[model samples]
Target: MSWPRKPLFGSIRARLLLLLLGGLGTLMLALFLLLDFSIDRQIFGRLDATLLGRARGVVVLLESHPRDDAWQELHELVPEYATGGHTDFVQIWDAAGSTLLSSASNAGNNLQRPPAPVPANAPLFYDLRLPDGHRGRAVGLRFAMPGRADEAVLVVAEEREQVDQLERRVHVALVMGVVGMGLLAALLSVLAVRGGLRPLLAFAAGTGPDGAPRVEPLPVARMPSELRPFADALNAAFARLQAALGRERRFARDVAHELRTPLAETRMAVELATRGAPSAQVLAGALASIDRMQRCIDGLLALSRYEAGIEQAQVEPLELVDLLRRSLALAATPAGKREVTLAASLPDECWVMSDPALLERIVDNLLLNAAEYAPADSTVQLALITSDEGCTLRLGNAAPQLAPDDVERLGERFWRKSAAREASQHGGLGLALAGTLAGLLGLRLHFALEHGVLWAELGPLRPIALPESPAS
Candidate 1:
């Protein structure tokens, strides 16, 4: 058979892992972004609090002096009092708005501001491009200096250069961490998929209908709990398909084998009639051969269909004792002529859901086989019994000892135990057909030999249940 075209997305394991990783990565990225925003807000808020506190402290320091000396004290406090590093710049302004004191030694290069005087009592924090063309954050504090007639101001500013540097470092670390984690996750996903799907891959590699290597189904012990059901289902389907395919192949081979005897007999009969003059004895022998051929053909056809599983039987409640009595009576006349005793020991009114015709056929086949195989004076015993669980039908006969392995091979079409009788009798398909019918009726058919007696048992209907009571 042609194979399904190879999928565009190959290796179910890889595709499954990639899909999981993609989703996991997206979720991790979202979490990282949220965390980054929270960190930025907290850092900025803390920095602003520190700046405001320091600006207020400068206002207190200046309260002690009316002159420029007080501003000098503020400058001296910068190295000890400022919260940040060298990037912090502090400067104080006089009433006339001339620069009084600066933390930087180069006070002449003090940062230039807009011509607008510090808007009265309106402390402002804003971004500016310094004379050096670098971005800076300026915090202007408007307050009255100590003992001064007019309120003065102190501006404490820090550069974007320091904050930008810190942010860049954090960004690099975050990117590295995410990329590393993503790569690790991908690797882990591949490993997980490979390990998880090993059973499926093994199953695929070893399974097919013909000339395929046998793969023992993966047991539940080998599977993860989540995957146990999938494993079990696949195993069941594989077993059924394999069995059905085996049955089809066997059916074809058995059909050809079984047809050979009848065709040969018919051909021999035709040859005999054409080759010789019409004597009464010769014509009689030819007619007998023709009759045997026709009987064999009919038997072969019936056995062929049953073994091929081409026929479906209707099942309903059938009385076991009645069915057994009917089969025994039908086989009794021929069995008596052969000097074989046919008897049935059955329950009075036991019932089962099975195809009545098929069950009768099964009984007939067994009785016929017993009559043929049993010693001339021996008895063929058939019995049907019922209990709380279900019913069983058994047939037993005294016969030549059968090897343990031969018991299993007995149901094969045309397989005979007696080499002397092989040429004269039909063997394999008869028992095989009986077994097939037993299976279709949802019964277990078994064969055993004990103390030189051959016995067969059929049991356990599929829809077995206690009989329902009449409505109250």
Candidate 2:
């Protein structure tokens, strides 16, 4: 059976807080455990030492006096062992396992014996239940008596209730301290996380009413070092978005401006037909205006399709020379009307890989644009230049009116040299569409005006070798 997945924390701030608090809590718990263990060890160590010292004192007394006077001296030297209220106890046993002396605190009961084979010089410390029924710690020692060859075992024990109580108090204090530090750490973590994310929050606040990003750039300098790269990326994205929005606005304005004249012309022509003007003339005007509008709309749609990746190029090997001739043939009528000559420099078969339809549109637009703009009786030159790398199609014409700087604006939509719109039937979208289609075909269109001639160069289009015939 599959188990349901747990939902993760959504907010970065919450995640960071949880991580910091969890790590700090674990560290504090470990520190508390370490300190508690060390403190407990130290407390018991001192208790064991005290018991050993008392046991050693009893042994010293036994060694100093003769057998007859040893017990009396031990009673005098260590009076606590004789008192009923005392917690300290001592027991001595002979080599033959006979008890010689015990503390009065034992109430005739003996302390538990140490394990067998106790060390001779070093004391052995252990824990046991005392005769008085209290938890206690003890030390065992073996020593030789004065004027005697036999060794005796001496055990010293004390009730550890007070030490355990102190340890409990220390444990409580440590718990309280750790809890306080954990709370403080959680607070600091929250503050640190919030402070670190302040820049991102500020960026969110800068968004527009429609939830679009504002034009103002994000403040990268004030952000943390780790977030600076993120901030820079966001800034760059916002800059591009702003540029795109600006372009869209300009495109809308230009489209409206371009269509307004034709629309007015169409409306006027319709009015004249209603008022009984010549039917042929009125219908001709209306049809011409409609045609211009259709062309503009079609160009806009084609450009939009290519830009949006809705139209993909289907590349194949095609003859560039034949394509150029077809484009020139199509532009012949317009060029002749403009009194411009169409000239071509061609090779027999220049094969290049490109989408045939898109390449045809590019050539047609370039030829039409040149024919419309070239001065009367000027020659529009179309050449196919081939090299080891690939082929470049160069189209040039006399552009005495166009300045060097004007070359860059040639591909912009609806851009024209003259302010008078009545002079030209073309909407100036031809070059823009051509450039866009060339890019979609993975071809580069470069414009350069040198010595009063405007040149539009397309390629280095990758050439494809001819397919061999069946006989070959």
Score every model by TM-score: 0.68, 0.81
RMSD per prediction, one decimal?
6.5, 4.4
What tens digits encode model 2's per-residue C-alpha lDDT throughout 1-472? 2333223366788788888998999999999999999999999988987887788777777777776577767667677777765388888888888887877767798789987667987888888888868888889898986765788888998898998899999999999999999999999998999988887776566545477876777677776687678778878887877766765676678679878988999999999889875699888988898889888888887877777667999999898899999999999999999899999999888888999999999999999999989999999999999898799999999999999889989898888887874535786789999999998988899999989999999998999888778984
lDDT of each: 0.71, 0.85
Which pairs of residues have clashing backbones in candidate 1?
Answer: 62-146, 63-146, 413-428, 413-429, 414-428
Clashes of each: 5, 0
**What is the per-residue lDDT of model 1 for residues 1-472, given as tens digits with 9 covering 90 to 100?**
3343334247686578768798879977996798678766766666666766777777777676655665567657775323333356667777786876666533345755534566666666666665345776666777866656777677766567777677777777887888898889888888888887887776555455465534677566765687678768877776766776676676577657655765676567677778887556666656665565555556666765665566888988777778888888887876787799987776666666889889888888887778777788889988866655578778899877577778888777777777666455434456777887887777888999888888898886533446689999
lDDT of 2 at 428: 72
Q: How far is candidate 2 from the true structure (C-alpha RMSD, Å)?
A: 4.4
**Top-lDDT structure, candidate number:** 2
